[model samples]
Target chain A: MSARPRDPMLPRSYRIESVESELPGGEVFSWTLRPRGGELEVGQPGQFNMLYQLGIGEVPISISALGEDGTLIHTIRDVGGVTRNMAALSAGEEIGVRGPFGTAWPVAAAEGHDVLLVAGGIGLAPLRPVIHHVLANRERYRRIFLLYGTRQPADILFRKELERWRGRFDIDVAVTVDRADASWRGDVGVVTRLIERGGFDPRNSIAMVCGPEVMMRFAVMSLERRGVPARQIYLSMERNMQCAVGYCGHCQYGGHFICKDGPVFPYDRLEPLFDVREL
Target chain B: MDDLAQVFAEEPFFSGFSDAQLRRLAGLARPEVYQNGRYLIRQNGSADRFMLITTGHVVLKAFVPQRGMVPLETLGPGDPLGWSWLAPPYKWHYDGRALERTEVIAFEAEGLRQAMEQDHELGYRLQKRMIEVIAHRLQAARLQSLDLYGNPAGDLP
Candidate 1:
């Protein structure tokens, strides 16, 4: 008989391998974790894990990338007590991790179609895995576009990666900033403006967007204007998730639990609840 | 200027204009080119004309005393460049600079305004379309001011 999956309620210890600050003030950073247990369960793109900070608290963080040596990576923005404490952790420090939970981006189903990824600020972390996946299986898709927008030039995430992607011939990458300094020479506007110049065939494209709620709302409108069906577009959602297993009522949205049923959902499925006031 | 009329007809901004209306607009338009770093319009300068970018980019900027030129937005090909010509005082509020070798169809504001007064139907259609463009830019500006991406709240899954 097949082995039953391990209990997700219990947390597994993971040692921090390295910590790199992604932004100027160290408010945003990435952590490479090594499982104290045998092997780490790799999370698919858009899936998240409950990162427990010992006795302090636990927060759900999206898996940014999967290391070749069975390690897991997560990029976090330090905002709350839990995240601020987690950011204080150094290499070799230990943190508890549970799950590779929730739904994933429809990478496999996107085969044979054009793929568009729109990310804003820290939202790019969750979509990075999908970018890696598509690039690994490049021949399976027709056209690939990555349009990223940040609050300012310094706020841009994965600068080197974005540069390398921009250099690539197969995939199209565009970066924009809400506010530009004298040094920034790229596009200056909301990310939706990039959609106007993206040059992708909306009818044959599958778009996955992760960003601020208002930005995503405007992006959906822009994508619809470009003729992409609502069903073909997806969004990564965020909420206050406590259990990460849907047991707690914290992350419930309308009829679904973001911890279990989503975190990633097609726009059509969430359209009804998307703009509903105070939902 | 039949060729120019065809170009105007092709632009989404002029989509509702009748063929005759496009021809009338084309009569007031003349192709102009600006090299990189050239100013298309200056702050508090006469807004004698407006432009429709045919190629390259234009950066909208406002100069601050300590910070120098701060870019507000970048307008690309097929984008409208100025609306200050439509109102009283008729002076540009900010600076418009060519980010690259840009080609634009510059329309004589005085001629267009006179035509609009004589042809109310044409004026109404053009004004309505301009209002839409203005509204879109206003919406974008509102979203930008929110600093949505900078807020760390709801950032985690």
Candidate 2:
């Protein structure tokens, strides 16, 4: 028998309101979406959507930000078959949408604590919404620190936004590049080094990190070294997610389904499962 | 107090050094500057001097067969430049190039070595700090060589 009508498993149509190339290379882009109906709604900071191109494939991308005007932002890197199709399309094109699925960054619980957002490369996409939320409710958090690391000056994303955030009195942002050329004046090293430069009250700090698993591992280690407990750190994990609703085991790790249970999890919960290498 | 000693007294690399110790070390140091594109030290060159950078930055680089002058690490103001002088052979392992208009407090390796030999206390503190810097750079190289971003598992490009 077929599944019931209006099934959560079924995809909904959403129009690509606009798309901006994220870098000069044109491999990555930030797409703004407007849903055709109430079928799929923008979810939480760390939640994701399964974007389906009619003739191609469907892939998961995090909701980078929920625009004040009600549009959803997705920063996608052109990778496998599906994303390539989505990136080549122009405005006014319709793409399939399903969810703002999975758990979100613990912004609510992080209130009243010093917030540290550590992101690497495209990892910044999933954490951008958290940054917007904290700024909107600036009075709730004690202090906000953002430490972002990318490959080089050429790979930096949202350049203007980073400059704006860097100018804010309340937000402390540190950026590092893996390598630097003649014109690059910023710190040239790993992002973890910024944890030491960032002045956060570790006892009252809650760190949210989104990056390559390798980078996040070191990030958590550095946070722990700085006296922030493991439970106080959260990271967003990326895996091959097919079903947004956890039915397919494509995104399973250590008996936990990344689709339903989390894309964000406390460092303590992920510690043993992380570094498992393709598990 | 000498201006160089005053600066050294406040730097992290020279932390734990008493004002008296800073003054003693500063005597063997001279001010030096390098323009952009100049090499502070070349690989295999005799490490006659070690430096404490005061302004601008220098990059540690190595020349691979196929890659020309690949940058390994960058050292900014308040960072130390050469550790090869502290070890035997006393030859640099990489090229240090000025990334900008760099100002440095250069210490004669022979003079500092003699001073350390005479003052065990000063030698112990300075040696420990140099070891830490060396260890840090070694770890950075290891991490960078991993190429964490190039093939990050599950990360989309």
Candidate 3:
């Protein structure tokens, strides 16, 4: 909860306290980082941080969860050389960390309404914290729904946590996959389709959606069809963020700098530019 | 029959039908229930009927040679199941099973086909709705086939 450092670009040295495999084949990992210098800068739900891999590179990864003892939990997919290298790092290895940056999900503002979280693939990582916050304040929200869809049963993230959440009577969690083999017994479809079956009161609900741009566009369309207003819906945008502080112009969308102005924005704010392909 | 007509009138699928059309269609429908794990339609079986799911879930699955049943999609309340009944050779391509005790307003495809042939307006309206359902499902299937979530570019920040 502390303020960011005076020089936003100055990356802090943090040692990886633990490295856990989040998915099979070690394609994805959850790394818990502890600041070697001081306390961890815990990010709000939907906020991302710039993780520097020494001389290699830095990529912006959303904070997946906050460890109980103040460590930062980041769920990362090994898609690039930097992420692949980071996955190879063992516990006690040091990496540069900056931010906890960008706008956050309006979890507090959504207190009195039905909270619907729609995620696809790795998009679930950013929304996991919002789920934790809502569950922690269970009584404040009327209903909470998490609709997630991934590529396959094998690609599902947070399997145990999803099962545990499903066990709770207060929250509704529906998981689906685009495809599955014979052994899988779950729903098979795009994440957007789950919106229709979510059974939330869209009129009084606030929806937070995160996924690929195409998936998010379809999700927004589905939410709108269910009567959720543009103002009540939020989306997390991903862009190439070289400088996490917005100086680089690498993550600009129209006039908004994703790093500072948003990684999260109300649907209404982006309506004009959302469907424009060349942006 | 009046009660069945009311049910059809209330369903989204039958939304624009006239009162007379609903009454005629209702004559072809009868209520059916399947308990959990019951097979609603077996693969290669005659697709003699289609249903308007009133409650519970139906999973459409295809059987693999060495593997077991692989689920293709799950349809629930307000969803219409089985379009194969409208086409020739009317055979189910996949098996539809109830994941829970399911209630549906089952329509006799043979009777409906006869009625449609007699009443062209009713046939056109019904066929249009079915086409919409088919188009929507086709679009969803295309999106699913893309494996959009599996695209590595989705992870790039």
Q: What tens digits encode model 3's per-residue C-alpha lDDT throughout A92-152? A: 9999998989999999999999999999999999999999999999999999999999999
Query: Highest DockQ: which candidate?
Result: 3
A1-279 per-residue lDDT for model 2 (tens digits): 985656667788889999999889777799898888763475999999888889788888998889777688899988766777777899999998878789999999999999999999899889999999999999999999989988878888888999999998999887888886645656778888778554689989999999888788888877887799999999898788988788999889898899888989998998888778768
The pairs that clash in candidate 3 are none
* Superposed model 2: Cα runs more than 4 Å off: A1-6, B1-58, B61-71, B76-79, B91-108, B115-128, B151-157
Interface C-alpha RMSD after superposing true interface residues, each candidate, one decimal: 2.6, 3.5, 2.4
What is the C-alpha local distance difference test score of each model?
0.91, 0.85, 0.90
- Residue A224 displacement in candidate 1 (angstroms): 1.8
lDDT at position A95, candidate 1: 93
Candidates 1 and 2, the one with greater DockQ: 1
Q: In model 1 chain A, which range of ten residues has the least summed lDDT? A: A180-189
Clashing pairs in 1: none
lDDT of 3 by residue, B91-146 (tens): 99999999899999999999999999999999999999999878868877888888
Residue B138 C-alpha lDDT in model 3: 82
What fraction of the reference structure's interface contacts does model 1 contain?
Answer: 0.52
